[model samples]
Target: MGNLKLFIGVLVAIFIIIFLLLIFLVYKNSNMKKNISFLYTKNIELFKANNELTKDKADLNRQLNGNDDVFSELRLALELDSVVNSLNESGDGRKIGMDKKLEGKFVKSIPNGVPLNFKGITDNYGIRIHPISKVEKFHQGIDLRASVGTPLYATANGVVEYSGMTSSGYGYLVIISHNFGFETRYAHMQNKQVVRAGEFIKKGDLIGYSGNTGYSTGPHLHYEVRFLSRTLDPINFMKFNNIFYDERKVPWQALVKAIDDF
Candidate 1:
């Protein structure tokens, strides 16, 4: 009978130990789940913070690019203004500094001076990427950086062949026909031109005002020099201090003969 009682006691002890082990396992599982939930919440918070940082970085970059464009425009304006003021003060009325020998010759009709008072050329005559379109193409003329309402002058004596707006990207355009198969084109002028088509004009006469018209990215004057209907670099003709002619491109000998015979 005692052995039977001892066996019952042993069974009771085993049951108690198993019950305590089950309780411990349940507590451990609950703790593990709580830890996993906490880690998941933390990961979500970190992901959201990363997204906010990315957005802030993009905004900063955009602001910097905008400021750069504004700074470039301001610098161009300052340079143009300084040169224009100096030229205006040096000359009598609209007579710019020109070579004295070619003052009364047919060579005088050559557009050998800058049409606008700009210290630098932004876009030269060649292949370049269009600012707005972002496509590589040929630029047929030089771009003189100027602000809106800046004054524009004729580069030489000529008759206005055409002066008005156009379907082309030149905006308000002006084409002048000069002697010796020479022509000058001015583009991106503000609204209507000061001169009309078929009107006679001297080298120093006012043509129009600068503007950001047509396909331009900003305000500037697009100047072109053409010989025999072929486009030439406008910068080669913009020698204000001396007489310059490209003998390779222009038949100066034949032109001089024609002028001398006339």
Candidate 2:
């Protein structure tokens, strides 16, 4: 009887040990799974953050390269006080303010280079003797003397408002409407069969050939700058430090030489 009792006690002890071992293994496996799950979640978050930072860096690079949109530049120039202060120091402070105000009155106005190549004034704005009429009259535009068939380009981006011959004076006329109450007219074109009405044109796009068309007496371009039908002196706008010829200038040999220097 004593031996049987001792054997039973040993068997119970072994069973208890085995059960405790099984319980410990189950707890350890659960904790390992929880740690692995936490590591995976953390890794995913880190990857997402890295991608966002890379995208932000790319955007900053584009802005530095001046590839930002025009509106963005204007907004930045307006919001940043440093830009305003610099323009003021450069003597263009008043002009910048005026430009902003005029933007509302007139259509969109952007710098479109120079009206003519740098050259001596042949016939300046104001009163001048008409080449064809041979009578002294108010010259609304300036004339640049160029060889026949010289390439003519638009001063700015605009839509063709009118493209036809005028019996009053202009021949082979091409009028571009730069929205904001501004329009430009090119007359005495040699041939403008390439451009049509209602076509979209960009600044510096070739529009026609220089010629002595309409009532013109010589191979030159009659360029006019008008504000809501009122003609303004084109020279006032061309008096910039850096100037280049557009469709409005006569493209004289002397003008071409001067432009090369510019």
Q: Which model scores highest in TM-score?
A: 1
In the range 19-116, model 2's lDDT, one tens digit per residue, is 99999999999998999999999999999999999998898777656677543443443433232222333354354664334332211243244544
Q: What is the C-alpha RMSD of each candidate to the true structure, in Å?
A: 17.7, 19.1
Q: Per-prediction TM-score, please? A: 0.58, 0.50
Global CA lDDT computed for model 2: 0.66
Which candidate leads in lDDT? 1
Task: Evaluate model 1: give its lDDT.
Answer: 0.77
Worst 10 residues of 2 by lDDT: 240-249
- TM-score of model number 1: 0.58
Cα lDDT for residue 87, model 1? 41
Off by over 4 Å in 1: 1-103, 240-247
